[model samples]
Target: MPRITYIEHDGTEHTVEVGNGLSVMEGARDNDIPGIEADCGGACACATCHVYVDPSWIGKIPAKDDAEADMLDFAAAPTSGASRLACQIRVGDHLDGLIVRMPETQG
Candidate 1:
């Protein structure tokens, strides 16, 4: 398991141990965390699971694919180079200390 920290727009934080191989969106969804909406249920068809990767960990995570990048355009919140769809990121030992922040809203 890897411990991932999800920070809400209002600054609330939830750190939990996520099972290896699960998507980051699953980590938040399974834990009842308030921020990630996951409307498409990890299909990568919706940007509701959007989150901004913490600055330090930005380059460490895998790069986004075309589908993820395309859907992010529909996110209700603004995005930056750090913007990513949680469903596209899988949890693994390499991401044990990963941190992601939720935007103010989701699409």
Candidate 2:
């Protein structure tokens, strides 16, 4: 399992051990971490699971695909270089201690 940390806009943080191969969005929802709406149920059809990848971990995660990039246009908050859909990030050993910052809102 990989340990992931999700930080809210107000500075609240939730840390949990996520099972390998599970999406980050699923990890958050399963652990009751607030902020990740995942309205599309990890299908990558919505931006509700948007998050900002920690700078240090930016190079670790895979680049966003065209579909995810398109969905980000609908995010409630402004998207930046760090913006990523949690549902697109799969948990793995290399992602241990990964930290993602949640925006103020998710459309």
Candidate 3:
């Protein structure tokens, strides 16, 4: 399992161990971490699970696909170079200490 840390807009942090093959959104939702609405349930159809990968981790994960990029346009908060949809990030050994910050709102 990989350990992931989720930080909220107010600086609240929730760290949890996520099983391999699971999406970051599932890890957050399963652990009851706030700010990751995951309204589309990891289907990549919505931006409710949007997050900002830690600057140091920006290159650790794969680039977002076209569908994810398009859906991000609907995110309530502005997207940045580090912005990513949690559902698109699969957990793996390399992401053991992955850290993502939640926006002020997910809409």
Candidate 4:
């Protein structure tokens, strides 16, 4: 299992253990993490699952694809090098301790 660290806007943190093959968005939604809206249900059609990849973990994650890259353009918090859609990150043994900070808003 992979444990993900979710940090809310006010600095509240929740760690959830997720199994392999489940996406980060799924992990958040299943555990009821406050900030992950996941409105499009991991479809990549909505940026509701938007998150900021903690800089320290940036290099460890894979690069985004074209579709995910385009969806991020509409994210409310402004896209930067760390911006990513949670639906794209899958839980894996190597992803243990993955840390992601939620945005102030989804839309």
**Model 2, span 53-72: residue lDDT tens:** 99999999999899988988
lDDT of 2 at 87: 99
TM-scores of all models?
Answer: 0.97, 0.96, 0.97, 0.97
Clashing pairs for model 2 are none
**What lDDT tens digits, residue by residue, belong to model 3 across residues 2-25?**
999999999999989999999999
Which of 3 and 4 is the better model by lDDT?
3
Error of 1 at 87 (Å): 0.3
> Which residues of candidate 2, in runs, are more than 4 Å off?
none
Candidate 4 lDDT, 3-106, residue by residue in tens:
99999989999998988999999999999899989989999999999999999998999999999999999998756789999999988998999999999998
Instruction: State the C-alpha lDDT per candidate.
Output: 0.93, 0.93, 0.93, 0.92
Worst ten-residue run, lDDT, model 4?
A: 73-82
On a 0 to 1 TM-score scale, where does candidate 1 land against the true structure?
A: 0.97
Native-referenced Cα lDDT, model 2: 0.93
